[model samples]
Target chain A: MTQPTARSGDRFLAAQPRGTGVQSANLADLLERVLDKGIVIAGDIRVNLLDIELLTIKIRLLIASVDRAREMGIDWWEHDPSLSSGKRGLALENRRLRERIGELEAGRTGRRTQSPDADYEDDETPPARPRRTRSTP
Target chain B: MTTPDLTWLYAVARDVEDGALDGLTGVADEPLRTLTVTGLALVVGSVPRSGFDERALQRRLADLQWLEAAVRAHHRVIAELARTGRTLPLRFATLYRDDRGAAAFLRGAGPRLRAALERVADRAEWGVKAYLAGAAPAPADIAAPADRPGTAYLLRRRAQRDALAQRFDEAMAAAREIHAALAALADRAAEHPLQSAEASGRAEPMLLNGAYLVDRERVADFGAAATELGRRFSGVRLELTGPWPPYSFADIGPEVPETVDPAGTGTAETAEADVEADVEAEAGFGADAGPDAATGAAPRIKPPEPRSPEQPAAAEGG
Candidate 1:
């Protein structure tokens, strides 16, 4: 709204408008509005709010990108302890990036404006290369 | 010994009678207090002593289940008071040292709070959510297949995906228009466009989420309009929730933009550095229609204890 918005993360605050046991279409908008924007009132409670403070920030940071997070190793949210096959793939990509950096340093004499997407350079199944020409079988 | 050092916080509104909703209490019997400035009552509740420490509050707020429950609880009681008067809710977690504190905050926020109440006055908040349902549209649905080397194959697949996507986009646009039409019949639209893609990987990622402030008495007309629109659009999922407090129209506060890198470890927050996020651009959280853990339908919270400790509803988002 045009009014000064309430910055999130005040440990001790009050209630916002809430609905019934039903969420509507503008659920996202309302969620952001009710959750994000509001009247600003910084508080000073005698007791320190250290414990629950980080909880919101920690999980608040998790609000978006949890799907991509799944692709990585931090699967804590899912409660999965064992690493998934994707972890190995991610490791491979990291190795390739390291090697690509090594190559760029050697090739450009330590100066480079752009980097290539090197992880996908090797493709035993790549269909873009020219077909082989054989004389006779 | 002092009384837990607990302070009460509440939401108030312009035009709500001073004594309109005094005795309301939230879960755990937290007495609701009202702060008035320029004729608006700022309704609020207290923060228990235990949650006072920054460290403790941080830890608890991070717990999805805990945060969700707290927010849901706050919403419930505020909604109850909304029945008799015009109201604007405070941001979740607002606290004070005592009645004087509540009054001081309200008094200080006098102009801003009153304006907000005025904006949502005589209006109600309703939500509409749409999902792209085909087993969660595959990533390939968003991007062209990298393996399709030949121009024809790539072009064909690209065309197919584009057509489907166009249809989806058009349908979503239609839904927005539908919401607009219905809202015109009542109150104003709360904020900006909200895309639910941030909460992906679920069976439904809430394709379109919006909140509208409408007149309370015209709630039936609003629902009927939505119903007719629902009939008009067969393939899309259309649901309307609430005669809720004007959450969409009210001011909670500015958001701290939270960004997750997706690189295994990521975090979300709001910064004033022009950093924008899709979640911030939207409204509302949790399903208002779920089993009430206390009795009826409780708000949908991230499962505290996931069936598999490994998957602790880590998949959930704002």
Candidate 2:
């Protein structure tokens, strides 16, 4: 598979054969391992705990923005069963309730569209949200 | 007044030959140097205090660009050293006032560091992450009866959701089975927190984020086992990365107080004895040896013997 976002480091290491101990060039892979793993030794210079927490939050935002750009139109969460099961079910339930409310409103007003039921058929499709892809540094 | 340069310690290892780091540069493009103490080589670099001092580092770490460059540089140096011998990679941004300070740390932490080096010797870490394959299975097309479109739509949606929930359960089961199989083949295994879709840069939900510490000779077998597991479980895709510098396995216990004097002192000697006793205790209980001891930790599975002469060397270095 071609990696469109492969950095120069990845391209350089790609020439090496598999199982040759090449480090991954993926930024996320690097950050996760480097920041989280490794032995902790106290240094003469004291790094504040608050500063580390702030740095972690910043890194998370940076990763989120980068991914948002790369996967502009793909909202995996909407269809992800593991992640959205409860939320998606609730959304479906709410939409059905709203359709019922619309039917009642139309009946009371006596001003119904020719095929109110047919108009609501498209509710099976997920609603499209505006996609925002912010450029990351 | 210009502040003195701080010593940035990258990693610790034994028997790092002379000139092993001849051309290597570390974070801040400083020349790499080895400060040998207690029979361990401390791979280090000199970074300007102006940039690396605690206050400056906290600010610089927030800048993504600077963080990336410095991180990559740090890994590059450690990776190079790892090629030469077993290395205990230190956490990023571990710095000291000078060589003397770094030496003080090594002296205080000597026995623990040595045991860590022994634990990781002739072994490398491999990362295996499993992701659910393919886009969410397109909602199955169960034809809704034409007569009552509204009822049919609702039924169809419910069926689709049900099927998805079932698939999610199956996928999770597959992840656990895969981890068990791989863990059986490794000396040590670690389950890191799963990365978010944003962090993984993949649309698929990550199922397993695992690191395995495999003997150098078994690197090939471990990779093959992962590949076979991927094939057997068609729904999950496995990404195998490394022979990494044993970052996940580099825990050398908590920091020793800097007040402990260099090797000759009573406090340092007593600390060293305590570390030796701890190491012996760990060795006695093979299953409980590592920090990330997996459940049902099998006695260290010896890799199948008979590796090609070139394989070990190739797996050790790029």
Location of the lowest summed lDDT over 10 successive residues in candidate 2 chain B? B299-308
Please estimate how well model 2 matches the true structure, expressed as its whole-model Cα lDDT: 0.62
List iRMS (one decimal) for every candidate.
15.8, 9.4
Give the residue spans of candidate 2 off by over 4 A: A1-23, A48-137, B1-3, B135-144, B256-265, B269-318
Candidate 2 lDDT over B43-101, as tens digits, reads 88889999988779866765654675687788888887787788999888899888877
lDDT at position B135, candidate 2: 38
Query: lDDT of all predictions, in order shown?
Result: 0.46, 0.62
Candidate 1 residue-wise lDDT, A47-82, digit = tens? 222222222222322322344444433343242111
Q: List the residue pairs that clash in candidate 2.
A: none
**List-wise, what DockQ does each model earn?**
0.10, 0.19
Q: Write the per-residue lDDT of candidate 1 for residues B1-318, one digit (tens) a residue.
A: 236655645467655555655665663357766545446566666667676445566556545545544655666666765666677766556666555656656544454455556556666676655443322233243344577546545554555556565656656566556656765876565433333222222233344555567665666666667666665654355545566676545653333322234673423311121232213223332222211112211212221111222333764421
**Interface RMSD, model 2, angstroms:** 9.4
Which parts of model 1 are misplaced by more than 4 Å? A1-34, A45-137, B1-4, B13-29, B35-39, B133-159, B191-205, B252-318
Model 2 interface CAPRI class? incorrect
